[model samples]
Target chain A: MKIGIIGAGAVGSILARELNKLPENEFQLTVMARTARNGFTVLEDGIKIFHDIPVHDILSVKDTFDVLFIATKTPALLTLKETIKNMTHGNSEIIYALNGVGYDDMFVQGIPSVVYVSGQQHDEYIEHFVNQKIILPDQSFTYLDRLIQIIENDESIHFDLVKDKHFEQVRYEKLLINVGINSVTALSKNTAKIFEDDSMVRLTRTLLKESIDIVNKNSQTVYISPDFIDYAMEMYMSYPREMGTSMYYDVMANRTTEYQYIQGFVYNLKTDDHPPTPVLDTVVTLLSGYEKL
Target chain B: MKIGIIGAGAVGSILARELNKLPENEFQLTVMARTARNGFTVLEDGIKIFHDIPVHDILSVKDTFDVLFIATKTPALLTLKETIKNMTHGNSEIIYALNGVGYDDMFVQGIPSVVYVSGQQHDEYIEHFVNQKIILPDQSFTYLDRLIQIIENDESIHFDLVKDKHFEQVRYEKLLINVGINSVTALSKNTAKIFEDDSMVRLTRTLLKESIDIVNKNSQTVYISPDFIDYAMEMYMSYPREMGTSMYYDVMANRTTEYQYIQGFVYNLKTDDHPPTPVLDTVVTLLSGYEKL
Candidate 1:
């Protein structure tokens, strides 16, 4: 099957290398690269591993693929609207491995993954620190089944392609996690180790609680219980103390962040009856100020 | 006449050097320092000029001075209550060259100065960037007359000791300036260069406006006209973009900031009729989170 991945970020690089391990007949993968480099490097376990994959300029791509993964950062995800059409057929299923939510409406056949892959794309190298899992919708689909079969049959592929039925719940949980971890990490400009500070924990938890209050205010959609705050904090603790979230890396690098889709997504859903989100509003304003118009 | 300056920071160091230049018979200056060093190096105009002054520990301040200058940071200013008694007599005048407001209650004879000194204390060098004026309370005091005459008579002294009659207006203006620039510079971990960014301007201006509204709500005491917003913005623009505020330097150096006396002073005065301060609350929370409880 012919497959295409648009972004060369952490998740995109991981997906490209893992799927490249499959038999050539089953997976013909191509990573679009606007940069001149033909290969990428990943630093794992204190060692540098280089992957040689066919890189094509995304804009120059004229060939269509059977499956596509939209692994770009949330801010750049929309630019692929027209370019994606040139890379996929009408039946092609797009799998999105992104952090923020509510962008699924952009594509009808798109499946948003819980993007279990954790890493950061530094200037010269991508650091793969944790799980190589991408949790997809448990519901059966032809392209997803084929991709899962290809990965499951390969014992060498160190990736868990989780097809979970509770994808929605876990996705919202990931959103809450981003809302808590990303905001503090980016604003404080610290790593996961910031949680070691009690004030950091309290401030982050307060932000998380504000976000939780907003989502759980009504049962219309995306309901997260109050207990999820603990779960989210625990998840934060589980991360390597040195590891940085995508937002943290983005801010440190002086680039725009994914706050629009992560914090902005939750904050924009405000209503008259919603509890006042002072922390969220302040965070959003700061983030917006950091992001240039 | 004997004089004691408590802090060795930017303001303290500058005051010590300027006062030291006065004739020995006219002015005897001593800088109290716990750190084992008899001299300070000030980087003026790219050259390191060393000022060797007698350094005495504050706890060992057995000699009383005719005039005392409290140039310590706002947080550490209150710690000198007992030690100050050893350094001053009933007739000795206390001059405070610090930022923020409402610390007058800490001293019975404390004459707050709208300090015009601009400099930053780096690791081992103090960078004197701008004016060395110290604005004293425009009121009649005994020592004030002697100090002003001493400074005015010396042509070698580059410091402008301005005893403005409109000192109250300028002091409040300085507080508003800190409310706008210090908060944004500290929270953003940026220098005055951030004002070049329109979003930074908007965010900083918004913070200043919130502070203005609160101070103007009940004009029983300190009243600042709305026009001060433009004046504050002009001050931000007038600053060298490369220069960092005191709070910015503190946060960058991982030390506690002056938000408690600056932003916190403005925030803690909230009344029932006060306008909601979501931005102020968020800035305070983030700053408090940065500061250890």
Candidate 2:
């Protein structure tokens, strides 16, 4: 497989580096960065592995691959689409390893949306903070199995894909987790330790409950089951103890956050009950005010 | 009266500089900063005014004022209390120029609560983005009148007090505005220009409505008047085109935000409806996350 990862961010870098470790030499990887990096590199368990991969410009590159992974954030999806249209020729499958739903709404008309899971980026260093899971929607189980085989062949990267409605459930669950963790953590300027504070848990619960209601309203089928909280709690326990979300890092850098895409998007959705989103409102106001300054 | 400012941040620094203009024969201004800043200053309308203010260690300070202005944020209030208890004598009237309400409830015991109307603070260098209109509770009108005489004598600082129940109303009103603007701007990384955005207006309105509900639940007289949006719009127009709240600057500087005190406090309020506070939740989360990183 000739593979191209459209975003040279942490996830893209990790995938590129891991794919290079395939012993069968059945896969070739090309990565894309906003600017040219030295090459593809991944820091795993303190070992820094470098793959002398070609870093192509989204604008200047002209090539087609068997697979194209659109690893950029949703806000940058339009630009990614434009780049894909201008750069690639022939057929290529694009996988979106991003947070949030509505992947198809962002891409070219005919392209299939591949859901992805990988979390956080620190400079060129990609930390796979969560389980590496990628799912293609249209029952592409065979394709997923092959892809997993290629990836898991190397012990460094863990990945799997299950094309079922459960996948959507998991995405929404992840959204709930992001809602509970990302926005609260960003605003409080504290780590998971803030959750340990008993006073903060009620506020955290309110945020989580609002997300659950909003998700329930938007989705045709309810993704949140009776076990959703337990599911989330398990994931929370499994989370990298000291890791912060990408949203958290964005604020730390004083760069604009993905509020419009994350909480901001949820805020835009018109719902039945006026879900009290005071926390999100204040955060957006402060962040927007900061940007103005 | 020897006035002490515990945290020489935007409000503290500016208030210190403003109070310094008082007749040297009557008032001795001593500022308590986390670190020493020489000669407190506030620049407004390109006019630079310097005050020969003395900065002291929180614990090393020895003198008490007839009035002590505690302008540090609420989260830091406990720290200030520890220092103030050690440094000052009893009978020190403490003026807390904070954003949210309920200082009386949190007071260590017998400490007088003072609230004010100075709605905006630019930074350590700039002050008085808008006119100074300080508010005191209606019951404290006697103290207000005395402070007004001292402040207006300078012909520089404009001061006022909330008459009747309007004091509590205005405080809650101010909380609504803070709830709407501070964290949202910080999280979105947008400017006041965002308020001009329709999505922002809707999100802010929801927040104001929700906060009003929360406030009303606690206080019988407080309700969401038809004029709430109008009040905010007028305030926005009154704000300097380039001015942003102190929360904005704090996030920009990567310093911890006052989220816990402002949005988080309001969101945590007990209410019947459990109004959705998505905006507040998201912004607070994002800000908290930033601190973790």
Candidate 3:
């Protein structure tokens, strides 16, 4: 199978190395490169795996792949839209491992249907943060089944094909988690450990509830269930004591955040729904003030 | 002339020494102390002037002076209420060389009238950042006039009793300035220098405008004129580049702040006035989070 990944970030790097392990998958992996990295390497349990996968520039992208995955940050998705089209000529199954919701509607040009999954990006590779996977509607799970079979052929990486709503439910659920954890972490410049405090627990839950309400209003059916909230709370409790959300990383690194898309977007939507979201409003304003810093 | 100064902080200390220097007036000075201090010390131009003013506890405060000044922080004001009857015995005139507005409504229970001024608290002395002296509308300014005459008698301490509104205007003006400068400094954990950036400048101005609107609606008909805004911008610009506000000092020292009187009071008043103060609201909420830290 010919496969292409657009981004050379942690997620792209992880899949490049792990997916290459399948003997059934005769993969000619192509990586689109913007910056010239000396090499691509991923270390798992102290074992360093190197990918000699052909990394090419957009101008040099000439081959059409059977499957393509975009593993970059969400903001870069729109920017890389034109460049991504050059790498494929026909229909290809495109999997999206991104942080937030609503990526399928963004890329409108000639591209195959997309699948969304929750994944964590590290320096060298992406670590899957969740067990379940959700593939949205209008996309056949057969493509995912093929992708999963190729990966499950190897014992190293796990695979699953979850119901589409399961993914949508989890996406909104993760949005609530991100809204609370990401915002408080960024504004307070504290880690997730601080959220363990009773006061922060209350504040986080309030913000989570607000985001859940926002997600419900936006969705055709209210996908924010009690189980989703419970699952989110459990995920938070399972975090490493010092683990911080992506927004927290942004603050520590002094970079502009996805706040305009995440919290700010939700706040703007609040007026249309007339949902009382003071907690989200307050955090949006606070995080917005810190964006420039 | 005799002056009794309460709350021997920087403002009280400077006013005590400067007022005591009225030789032709032969001023008898007594400083009220919570715990007995070594007396008022003014360090000006490498010369340290110390006055052996009699210090008395609030319960035992008696033998009223010709003029009295209250220079305590707002948090300390409520405690002084309990001792007011003893503190204001006999024919004594009171002056409040404090930070905020509306002290007469607070301090006039035991004493019929008092004076007020607005300025910065220097270390163990008051530095007149802005050149103006305001006296409130009280019967005691006649006696206050004699004390002012003694202060003006000396060419060193330059001051004069301007109209009462001139004083009242600046008191709220200083409160607004504190509302702008102090709270941001404390919350961001940065010096006043941060306001020089365009984003910080814009945020600070938004906060100032919100606060000014709230103040005008709830308390007085105050306009934060363009000139006043420029004046505040200039003051922030002229701050010793690395200097943080006094509230920053409190936060760094891990002491409670006058936020209750500043932003806390403003938020509460906004509820009463039916005006929403989201900027101040967010600031207070985040500051509360910091306090929890």
Best by lDDT: 1
- Note the DockQ of each predicted structure: 0.25, 0.35, 0.12
- DockQ-based class of model 2: acceptable
What's the CA error at residue A109 for candidate 1, in Å? 5.6
Interface RMSD (one decimal) of model 2:
5.4
How much is the lDDT of residue A38 in candidate 3? Answer: 47
Model 2 over residues B89-193: C-alpha lDDT tens digits? Answer: 555666676656545544442233334423344455545454444566555432335665678666865443234446666667777787777755666554566
TM-score of chain B of each: 0.94, 0.82, 0.79
Please compute and give the TM-score of the first chain of candidate 2 against the native first chain. Answer: 0.81
Q: What is the Cα-based lDDT of residue A120 in candidate 2? A: 59
Question: What class would a CAPRI assessor give candidate 3's docking?
Answer: incorrect
Residue A44 miss distance in model 1 (angstroms): 4.1
User: Could you tell me which 10 consecutive residues in candidate 2 chain B have the lowest summed lDDT?
Assistant: B109-118
**What lDDT is obtained when candidate 3 is compared to the true structure?**
0.61
Clashing pairs in 1: none
RMSD of 2: 5.1
Scored by DockQ, the top model is: 2
In TM-score terms, candidate 2 sits at 0.77
lDDT (tens digit, per residue) of candidate 3 on B169-254: 65667777787887667655567667666656766777777777776676755555656777787878887656667677666565
Encode model 3's per-residue lDDT on A1-293: one tens digit a residue. Answer: 77777776656665555565556446566777676454576555455656676566645677876777776666777887776766654456666665655556654322222233334456665444433333334345434456666564657754333335355554555556777778777766666566466656666776777787776677774567655656666677777766667777666665667777677766666646475666676566546544433
